[model samples]
Target: MMQHLIRFRVFLFAALMLVLTAPAAQSLAQIASPYDVRLAYVWQNTVTLADGDGVPLEQTGPSFAFGQGARLVWTADGSRLYIALDNGLYETGGQGGPAVQVPGIFGRTLTFTHDTGVLYYLETTAPQDEEPGIVSFPLREANTALMSGGTGKLAGYFGRFASGTTRANLTFAAALYARDGGLLGPGRPTLWPSYGSNLFGTCCFPDPGLGIFTLGTESYSVWDATFMPGAAATNTTQTYLAGPTTNGVIRIIDLITGGTRDYAIQIAGGLGTIERVAWSPDDTMLYFISRYNPTTPLMLNVETRFPVDTSSADVTLYRLNLVTSTIEQLAWRADVYGISSLAATNEYVFATVVDSNAALINAFNTQQVAASLPSSDALLAPYMPQTHLWRVAVDGSSVADVRDDVWGLAARPIR
Candidate 1:
């Protein structure tokens, strides 16, 4: 029952195909501030060189950007890239060249084994129905292997998080699995029935969600859950966040004993919606990004949060003390619209700031994003918005800009 309950929302393949079939949108222009900002991105269906800072490296990509939703995955040593696209898994030449395409195949969430160059993808196909399972192929292969079978639902790629919370379970390759469209195939093997040793990473970083269901026009939260990575004794204790529905409450859950504790967060500033959440490396504090109201005026001359996109000035980064259950504002910039995609390591809280006016950029580049996209799903914006990378310490000190002119950024997952 525990395994069944946990297998609710795993692959999310429909989300992938839906995005693949969606129409193209706009692109964000590279920031030209004389400052170098580089990021690996799929442009015109080719694997282009991505630098952490915004700078063009000696790399080539496809003649046309992928015309659908896809994921760009790098080899362990960053020598090559496997691009999952509408056609199939496309390979890239790190130094810039035409992308190699495998005809008649489509994959979602391309990921690499923690220490190996082996590439795996969430493959779903028709007729067989169950064929849309987890499949893997090396850079040299045109043929693929069905790593695991599925009940025609989308699943997760086999990999670990950058924080070192390893995912080593060959049986359950998905670090955390859940269902969205509906309850997926029950008989599909959730654990590695055959290839248990073929998995990689730190093992498994499993997560449990508070059971939520909708009835008629109303919504009900029967449970709450949240998990943190820590020592062995602390790792099994997953806390579930509960709700005021109006404000919000943190529900700490115990994975081993199925026990729980409730703590109401006295959110500073004003009540806001939580988009992302992470914990301090020490497991003492919880951090989140929210469109929280400001209790006081923002500091001047600092970077402005790009609120123009949303037309609301309510994005704030907050931290909560686990022992005291007290929440406080860690940082905010009224100048920028809002904080997005928050991730915290022991050393820094990484976040993306919507700091630029995407509308004022070149129309040609915007057309590239729009024309190249498969559709205008919420995953990809209509126009690429100008974004910058920022990080701060857990104590909210050493706040600094890592790169500017970056429209999107992702930390290499395998450490």
Candidate 2:
């Protein structure tokens, strides 16, 4: 009897130890995901953080009045959402968290460096007194509780700023600002395309670790050029990716090795004209939206489709395998007006698609006319293309509408 009782006591002790120590073991293991919000976007002048299903996890007010230029980004850990507005920059705590302005931030474009914990922004020819350049601030300063650390200037006289982990690294247009001081040397040549207007901020999409940036031609002539920052302006071995040329040619350029490959992607009925492109999180695939029309040139401006003329166009989403060179048509939105933007996470590729119909077109035209007037404060409503947020599985399995009347989209960066 005593032997059985002793065994029972030993078992009871072991059970109690597990119950007391299990929480610590779980805490030490890395969290698969720290937060619930997996995407961030702007709709109706509000910035929203959403989950995989497009459910609103947290949101900030109609703060972005002129949200056309506003940039929304989340911290690497997904703890905060930074909304870059024309007026200033602000941050939120992700669950309907009140926004607190990051003081002294006056910039147009903003990008966060995950590894460095730095928030870099483009200080345009703004406020007229301060010198225009690339300025940065530690993200801890943006925290509502600890808004202490001030700003610092990194580089001078740049048209754009972007953070990269691949060979291209940190690119400040016409400037070379390395993450570590002087790693790329001073006065390095830039890859800014001369063929098109300096729309580098919009027309270019950077691969996370691929050392490649996909480019598109927006209302401009398609041209070829070879250039990469931190290298000679032109390398003899370097080949350039032609702009969104005729016949849906997708160019993948290697910034690290100075090589280029062109893929002429096509759909069932005809050729595809690329508008916007996005890179998957793993950097193995690229998601792009193109207009498929065999007969007429349907490449209207991706933005500002004034005098809307997309009646005969069919906008489709396609996934191009970087490893296999295989093109897969994931989702098809036929008879649509246009797709303004494309973004991707590990699970889905989200697009902001505009609906095409005759009546909405007329109202859009009226808004365009009113927009021209300096005194007009008109809202783009009742005819705003019936815009909605859509997500298609990365594996080309399914597609669904996540939200309505949404414009800008971004996938939360996972650290």
Candidate 3:
């Protein structure tokens, strides 16, 4: 009888443990990782964030007016959304609350430090023709109306000298400022030297191990730049990498060691120029769009439509293997439009297209490239007749989904 009782006790204990652990395991399976990508969008004035499944997670106010040149910046906690426009800054909490206008901006790209919660903004008071500078505001004071009332020049320009001119006759060189107005280093100006040229777009990734990745325009090249840990000075070394530019090739300089590398892409039929370069989430591969004769006339001879091979106008997405220095064409569909502004996550890549009456978001997965070629249903979805921001997983499982009715789209891993 005691042996039977012991057996029953052991069985009961085993059953009890299984019952206790099953719910926790199922709960974990259902809880998505924070790193799992969710997209945010702004329609009219309201902003919303949606999960990979296209389900609405959160939505903000309808009073938040985002006109031209408006961009969204999610707070470090992902609980607040900061909408930066050419006029001012508007902020809305995550739970679809009322968006309040924060006073200090007069048209600049704002950068927020995830570490200190300090807000930095580039301030340029120079005439449209003169050199520009940058400035910063403490996070606590950022909400004030007169946050940038004082002209604090974080960096200044050193005039460029002409061949026959004295120092007095030299023109002030154009200046470029960090998106966030933080002191770059301990130089006399406390700012990094900027050539003052504008580039297509800016991407800022703050790394706890590596300092930061600042690319676009006169800032830094993606192919080069050895980012050091906890250091402000980029190594002067550089390498020249061949790029797909109008000239067929452009120099890629490594900001760190100042080393240069030469890279060339063999485009069939004719040489093409690169429209944009997008990096994978893991930085293992690079996706670039190249077009042949982009300026070729699309409509010819006033009335009659030109029988043109629009397929040639199609932007080809090529995956570059950074390790082997090899390039492969992934997709070549003529129906997709505006292939320039493409964003990639771990699961998929999203590209926007325009048809006769509506805009469509197309998705391509890295893993299922062979299967997705020629026709992609995710790309040919129920199109919306309006403009909006769309995102997709790079992995290909999650379909393309719309985020908001915003123009420019920017995303970073939620570390």
Candidate 4:
């Protein structure tokens, strides 16, 4: 209503460094995804449906637990189901029903708008102004009350949206600690020049306006995000995307040639932080999820296996190729160090790894016996990694698992 209360106070100060660093015990060895949990795990239970390499599709599919907000999104064509429990956001179908509850939508990083079912959550009503309110709901059926100026037409469309009568606009390569970050397609609000992280109290995921961004450092808490898919109408920028950009820093906005392309991420083991991206409904490839912070020195003085070493990380899944711009490396899970979630379907590219290698290789070997323990709290070794659900092949060729205790994977969009 006043542009959603000024888009909820500029998404409450660009999500005040991610709602004041929400880590109520999440860091399960850095599992940052399942496409960042947007698919909501679809009412989980260990679903492992694979094909495209790591063969194992729908092995019952369901198994989740990560605190009040257990998601499972779906709706664009797969029927219906928008689960986000902790007692809020619910709706079901696709082979099950009566879960209702979509009124007033609750917290979590939900997103949708492809064919326009309109939903964009992150609300806490009024938690003593700890700031949290950016709601938008509409699944039809006389369930109204998501009005924020009639023509946002579902901000930046996410899954399958490109048939056009004027589309292709979402802008923002800016980052002075982001604000209004960048409005997704439709009109006005295209500001730039806020290059790279410098945030203060991060809780996460904000810097999504299609030209990707997920930059986080909190002085070295390290996280390099940058996502894609904002109603991509192919051409006008680089239809088909990926992130965590670094080949020469970033900036690539061109809403139909408003112009701006500093591009230079020619890739190699130097690209970091574009943790997830998807495309290939003929937009020409671009299945991604790169991330880094490696120090590999395995055995005899081990470097990183997360026995309490600050920047422990690793994750890969590449396939660029916007017509030969080339970049392929299909799958590589170094026993999972981090990667919360990712999903991109045209032919599969879903992920949810957080491996933590049996909770950081143990039996007097973790941190190599906690460096002969003497109590740094026993040299710290509190492992908690377990969340798998992979599927690869956007042309990089198969990489299966399909589902092995998954609590993240919501890919059934396409409109």
Worst 10 residues of 2 by lDDT: 1-10
TM-score of 4: 0.27
Which candidate, 3 or 4, would have the higher lDDT against the true structure?
A: 4
Off by over 4 Å in 2: 1-33, 66-69, 76-79, 93-96, 126-154, 159-271, 294-312, 360-381
Ranking by TM-score: 2, 3, 1, 4
Instruction: For residues 161-208, write the lDDT of model 3, one tens digit per residue.
Output: 111111011000100001111111110011121222211112112211
- What would the per-residue lDDT of candidate 1 be over residues 319-412, giving only the tens digit for each residue? 8787887777777665444443344555566665654233322322344333232322333343334345666667776677665432222222
* Lowest summed lDDT window (length 10), candidate 1: 175-184
Give lDDT: candidate 4, residue 159.
16
User: Which regions of candidate 4 fall more than 4 Å away from where they truly are?
Assistant: 1-38, 42-76, 80-282, 289-294, 297-313, 316-335, 338-341, 344-351, 366-382, 386-406
User: What C-alpha lDDT does candidate 3 achieve relative to the native structure?
Assistant: 0.34
What TM-score would you give candidate 3 relative to the actual structure? Answer: 0.49
lDDT of 4 at 142: 16
Name the lDDT value of residue 363 in candidate 1.
28
Best TM-score goes to which candidate? Answer: 2
Could you tell me the lDDT of residue 173 within candidate 4?
14
TM-score of every prediction relative to native: 0.42, 0.56, 0.49, 0.27
Residue 17, candidate 2: Cα error in Å is 61
RMSD of each: 14.9, 19.3, 20.5, 22.2
